[model samples]
Target chain A: MKRGSLYTLAYAAVLGLVCALTLSAVDGFTATRKAANARAEEVRNILTVLGVPVDADAAPQELLRVFEDNVTEEERGTRTFYSYEHSAKGFLRAVRFGGPGLWGRVEGFLCFEEDMRTISAVTFYRQEETPGLGGEISSSAFTDQFEGLSAVGPDGSPGIRVVGDGADDINEVDAISGATMTSDKVEDMLNRTLEEMIGRDGFDG
Target chain B: MARADKQACATCGKGVCDGKGVVTFKDGVWHINPVAVQVLGICSALAVTNRLENSLVMGAALIFVTVGSNLFVSLLRNITPRRIRMIAEVAIIATFVIVFDQVLKAYYWEMSKQLGPYVGLIITNCIVMGRAEAFALSNRPMVSMVDGLANGLGYAAVLAIIGFFRELIGTGGLFGHQLLSEAWYTPNQLAVLAPGAFIALGFLIAIFNAISGANREEGSQR
Candidate 1:
């Protein structure tokens, strides 16, 4: 049977309305849980960077509790710092850093040991680089290289280097092969954050 | 004709167990598998098959979307206007896809991050739309659901196989567990790249075609 134009229009309207309602209901139902999960993920990243012990399988609430009990959050000069007092390592500080990546914004936490120049850990919790290439920045193989590296160059510049070739400098780490653009962007962003951190006084204490 | 049988089955309500249902199941899972045979929805198959976990989750997502959309489409098949049917189908399919995506983001945040936009891209996967247009529009709701499940399984099975080989060869592991010792086996980097998906899928389709071709020959002779 042929459908009249009126019937077609009505059918379209009804279907569109139903679909909209369904999506809205689903979005409403999941909004709270999704927010909690996102918050938990951020907390997990902060805790991991600050050298605080975190359960790998901790729930959202559990992770928040750990963050509260161990890490203290303070805002200083537009940058929020997460500080943890480690018995062996002394005071550790972690600050959020973000900038333009190859595809989108690359964001992560950069932590420092008590000395303020010694790297503690780096975690690229958010990035949109090419998988298997630039995407490796988030992988432990890449991030682990930052551990024990100095934020200051041998020349006393307040930045680290992401070298394309083998890293031979005290402040340089090997950039991911075949991801030159992403490497350069990450280098710029890290340096930008490092420069700002170093220029500020009283941070070392 | 198949069309006649479909109309009869739609009215009979016994289509699920009748010979038609068995044929539909076989056709979907093996004879005309979505990925292996028809080659529909290969985009997600390639993107997610790099890891077994991602592939399985993607497959589950497709299964959920297809089954849900097919049931709704079949139920409204009669009243749905032909001119607006495609739009209606898309609206229905998109709803299911978003629901799955939202739930994944809420409950399985890590996996959701791994999948990224691929879960949202399920809205454009032709397999879901094709099944709705071709089978659900004609068959009974129950039979259409069976068809959806079968097709989903077909897609999922192919993805799992590809994922298994890719992860094993690429990373010397399965589901992130190290299976091959680094001392003995060096991971083939190519297997983890985009090209690796093409090579694995190509081999899978060839093997499937060869076996099905042989089966057809034996059946004709019998």
Candidate 2:
């Protein structure tokens, strides 16, 4: 009813309207580009793990080109995975898999050698872990250790182990020092998620 | 030199060419630099300074938010009710922050992802709020915009220097390229973590203080 209160309410309403409009316009303009970049990044990550050696500075179109030319999607029962084969090199298979991370779904691709028992590379495309701590799991420092490591043990058990301090086994990678939960989650995912995928449809190496 | 006249210029009307506005604008950025001097938003400074790409992107985002919010706040300063001014300022700042976030997500998705929550956390950065209240609310639009930009650069400068050291020494790389040969050099892992950031920042602040102090002596004479 008061004059000043009416002005304040009108002011708030107008400000809110303008903000909504601005944000919507920005969102509209950016949505497609964001999706495209995300797709390119996914392709790039897969290409990297496949030993295809994607240049980080390569254009999005170039990355897509490589992906289209080199990668083929295959189905095993209900599961789908990517396989890369070259005339010089034998065959490399990659699976895009993840489970719950410390904060949210951590999604990434893991590529294996033709033998299917050794991990050739592991790359995380998305993770919601604490920065500089658990988040380091995606860094090459951590993922590089997975390369050339056995994902399955000699006696047919979960072979990948995450050591909290230091690791001395071929199948072990040192965990991030300050990120115990995230490291543990990664260890669990490696052991469980990979096995679940393998059992779900009996993936043929 | 004129004390009485200086006080009068402080209350000059908007759209006026008063030296007070200019001086305060400069002061907000320099003599009272947000990061080095005032130490307002050090959280992002440390977190993002581990790499040059991240620090640059974060700095640009902060500049965009600060300048955008300052301009908007100055434009609406006359109409914004006193009782709810803080709320209005926050809403305006958040809007710009989201715009920055969306732009990064669209164009620089990798950098955007690396920066992560820090981009969204700009709304909570004290420097933005500090400038909005201390400078923008009571100044002309142009002055407020300049003030915001200068302060953003001040913060950026510190972040970049800290980033340079962290990236160079911690990773033996600059912006992810290995600068030091592995055979001849090894990285200081401590510089890759938060404690390293604190140590780097402390030394930087001390160095900046000494340099600025010397500069002030010459500045006063001129």
Query: Against the true structure, whose TM-score is highest?
Result: 1
Give model 1's TM-score versus the native structure.
Answer: 0.90
lDDT of 1 by residue, A1-205 (tens): 6668999999889889999999999999999999999999999999988878878888999999999999999988798999999777788999999999999999999999988888888899889899878998999999999988999999987899999879999999999999999999999999999888888798644
Candidate 1: the clashing residue pairs are none
Locate the minimum summed-lDDT window of 10 residues in model 1 chain A.
A196-205
- Deviation of model 1 at A134, angstroms: 1.9
Q: In model 2, where do residues sit more than 4 Å from their true spots?
A: A1-3, A75-78, A86-89, A101-105, A113-118, A128-136, A139-151, A157-183, A202-205, B1-17, B176-186, B210-222
lDDT of 1 by residue, B17-120 (tens): 45478888899999889988888999999999999999999999999999999999998998899888998999999999999999999999989998999999
Flag regions of model 1 displaced more than 4 Å.
A165-168, A201-205, B1-19, B214-222
CAPRI level of candidate 2: medium
Chain A only: list TM-scores of all candidates. Answer: 0.90, 0.79
As for candidate 2, its clashing pairs are none
